[model samples]
Target: MSGQGTGRKARLAGSLLPPPGPARMLAVAALVTSLGFGGYTAGSVLFFTRGAGLSTGQVGVGLSLAGLLAVGGNILFGRLADRWGPREITMVVGGLQVVALLLSTVVDSFAMFLPVVCLLGVSEQAGKVCRNALIGGAVDGDDLVRTLAYLRSVLNGGIAVGAMLASIAVRYDTRSAYQILLFAIAGVSLFGYSLYLFVPRTRPAPRLRKKKDFPKAPPSISYVFTGLLCGIVNLGDTVLTVGLPLWVIGQTAAPKPMAAWLHAVNTLLIVLLQVRASRGAKTITGATRLLRLAGWTMAAACPVFWLAHDFPAVWASIALLIGVLLLTASELWNSAAIWGLSFSLAPAEARGAYLGKFSIGTTLREVFGPVLVIGLITGTGGSGWFLLAGLMAFASACAGPVVRKAQRESGVSDGTLARGRSGSG
Candidate 1:
């Protein structure tokens, strides 16, 4: 690293203890990117169901397939960002998202819609990978955790706002509403991609010259386990994104407007509470602490959906809101911890690959979570809520041990220490 890079790293490290300028910029970009992404998610369900008239099961299939495509995109773009730099890849991916969203406005058939959704999913994954890689390069250890938390909060916050707007659009005109959303998403993507250009490119760390000089380290078993655990916990989100709205529109006599409110409430709470939650998470050094808290919270939150089925009952709305809030809280904790651990655990030379593989957990959730929820809901009828809740709790409980073992076996407690020791060895 150059003298300038060294100074920058020191500054970033210092900011984890306080606050810093680069961290703020990274947060802003994350917020913007999340807003664009959120709007598309909020809008897509209504578009497929109301406008295109797809069945709930069909929608799940489409989303799952799209998610699988995104798995590939996430890995590819994540590595590219690390190799080529986040700035270039972000710009390219952001532009692709804009084009994909715009194209969705013109295409009405499932055949056309399927391909577009797949491309959009890929675009979403690429932008996220690039954004996180950039943030990791710019921030230090503790700040990285806080940064990830804030980024998630902003993303959820944007989704809340976008979902609210989509709700309004659906009330007036579904087609025109989506058209407007596409424009807004394009604008946000452009602004974020532009800001990315201003960030300084980080030089790659130097490679070790000799194999024997390298320390004998245990393979990253925990990393893979963490990925699996994340995939399971993410089922809660998949349920909300696909199952909740479908359930609402199908079971309730209430107007479709209620779906927007449920989504909005979830997004709003995440945006507002994530920072506070992340700050508190700083006190927790062990992955076990974070994962246990997240699992318990999600397990408790999942059964609240049964209340939503009662439509028109005051308790239904309250229960649904409370459940969403709890789930988001779990997300905030798990996300921060995961970000910190992944960045800390990865080999310096292969940080991008590690992050990409970590993201596969999320992508897999996107793929199978929906399908699982749909099947459970269809097969057992009203028992899907219980099933989802159980899955979340199980997943959460498993994540802690998996991460701790990974940490101990790798003989690295944190990424910064790992990087230093690796250099010396």
Candidate 2:
């Protein structure tokens, strides 16, 4: 009876925590890393402008420079990961985060902070590639997709927790308040690194092919279309994070704080539904189909957003919530689909490099989206959103053909390896 009780307790504990494995360890690392970055980001503007005594202009310049460095680093470190290994690089990335956050807390000048900002940026991008690549190289098939979804859910959970803590600093609105947030963030970074230390060491993946004999050929046309389709859908980042909130304020009759609430809904939905959504994402065809459908769901949400202005206050709130719900739901599907497709598309040996290139789509969208949103999406109002939605749906339709063509170009006609290995280009 005592032995039975011990077994039951262990089973319960295992269920509550992650099952004992690298996946759980990776999830914990992702949680703490996201927490630190999220908190740092929430308090950052005030930290630089008030606490550190830098002008808004100084802050923007520093950030833009850092972003450029990070963009370059993703591609560079990707190749490096393919060469050296993701595990060692991942450790270095975590260490850099710890050093950068703690150091940034003390810097009082733009000149001093600029380098730190750059370091943080590189750390962020490098960590992203290394972590994803580590998972790609270490895990496979259904377990791969499942783990990816959980890691993402954990990332959002961390951000939510970090943001909640930062809310306290927001209320106090003092340099000390901000400093304390940074201190907490630094501590969280260290915690993440501790989790990183426990991850079982994984071997470096071999290169896809040696380049010594032949000149490197450009990727085929099919690959370009596939990439474009992926990138267009990836623009949901701008839509979910920036466009939706701004649209809520300018276009909808809903209150401003509702925007935050709607985002809460998004985060909550991701936590609840992301893993379920990923169940179908274990293969390329299924993932592609899911992403395609997700686009239409997002499309349907647009007009609901537009029509919210026509209703009275309570009903308008209802319509707006409905729209946000659709959008967030679509986000869940799209995230899972994209994960499977991205994971499967890369060659086994070049998984790191492939994932690195895949990340550039989001980076590119982030760089271009602000202007696109402010100048076009918001400028044209509901009509513009309708147009944007139409384009997304079109992309969804095209995604199937494009992915099929990409599969053909990769020399897979039967779709067996395409589903099983996911090695496209």
Candidate 3:
């Protein structure tokens, strides 16, 4: 009987993997989109600082403002996706991004570039919302978690590759090289947009005839609270994206290739470990467990930056890699669990609004996270890591109860509680 039970569990695990079907095809489309976005992001700092001739301070401000615009774009498109549908928004946004990239090649002035970045931010928001919404709509049960994990891994990998290509382009110092990179980005984005052509249109779920289509109850305040916690946790990415690279370049002797190694480590871990992490998290209930794990992991990893001071370059690289592994694992769980919880908890008619609210949380993180990290590093010198660690711990503590409340409110159980209650009864 025990052997039979073990076999059933194994089969269930196997079934959770996304099968080669339309869902898998959509995942592929998502991969292509990631490649384009990743390539652009990897090259953005260099382009702004070198290609467009912006000072470091100006670059920081421009990037922060772009992040703010991204928040708006994410919320706007998320609401649009909920109101209209994912397919239309994906195509429109992806197409716009292609145009934005093409326009970027010609913009010679900072003023011209700023508006373009804002437009690109909108495109980024639309593409991300549509792709994520599609994945939510397409997959079911445990497969949904696995699918999202796989997608994130692919996205990170694409970013790594794009960054590498951008490095090569910048090395050439030829006008043609930059132009080629821009056109390549546009081409990949177009390919990604083309995938939307194949996606079937889904109608909004029917409203209850007995009541109004609007939410009958007051909005769940827990959602907003949860969003704030999420924003705090998301600040970790700002450290990863901007802080780490800058630290490596400024402190280390080998500035040129350091960013590549950092990006590679981040991407490699996600690609290899994300699906495994999702599998482990299958029995974990609610967003709290994941959020707590992320918070603690981030907090622990933050202080490890001090190790860079003592170690040889290779050893430091390894230590940083280990730190990133823990960070990415936290990311793998919190991201999937949060999205799943958000969708599950949202009123059927208000999924879009809820997603918009969620985007706002992320946007707040993006805007403030970078500025805070930059300030802490510049002001206090080496204490930025400790500050980040403390913030993460605080956020994690706040997230736990909210996630628990969400689980109870949604009437979902993670098996253990149900079994325990049945046994007790």
Candidates 1 and 2 compared: the better one by TM-score is: 2
Q: If scored against the real structure, what TM-score would every candidate get?
A: 0.79, 0.86, 0.84
What is the Cα-based TM-score of model 2?
A: 0.86
TM-score between candidate 3 and the true structure = 0.84
- Between candidates 1 and 2, the lDDT winner: 2
**Candidate 3 residue runs with Cα over 4 Å from true position:** 1-17, 206-218, 249-259, 280-286, 310-318, 405-425
lDDT of 1: 0.68
Candidate 3 lDDT over residue span 1-425, tens digit each: 99999999877544433467656677677777777777787676677677767777876776678778887687677666655666677788888889889998876777887888778877877577666665555555456667777777767766777767777778875556777788898998899779867766643444422234533321666766677787788776777777777766665433447765766666677776676676544443544577788888888887676466457788776667777777776676667656655555554444555666666677777778777877765456667778878988998887768867755664546532111100000
Please provide, for model 1 over 329-382, each residue's C-alpha lDDT reduced to its tens digit, 9 standing for 90 to 100: 777666655665666666655555567777888888777776688777655666
Best by lDDT: 2
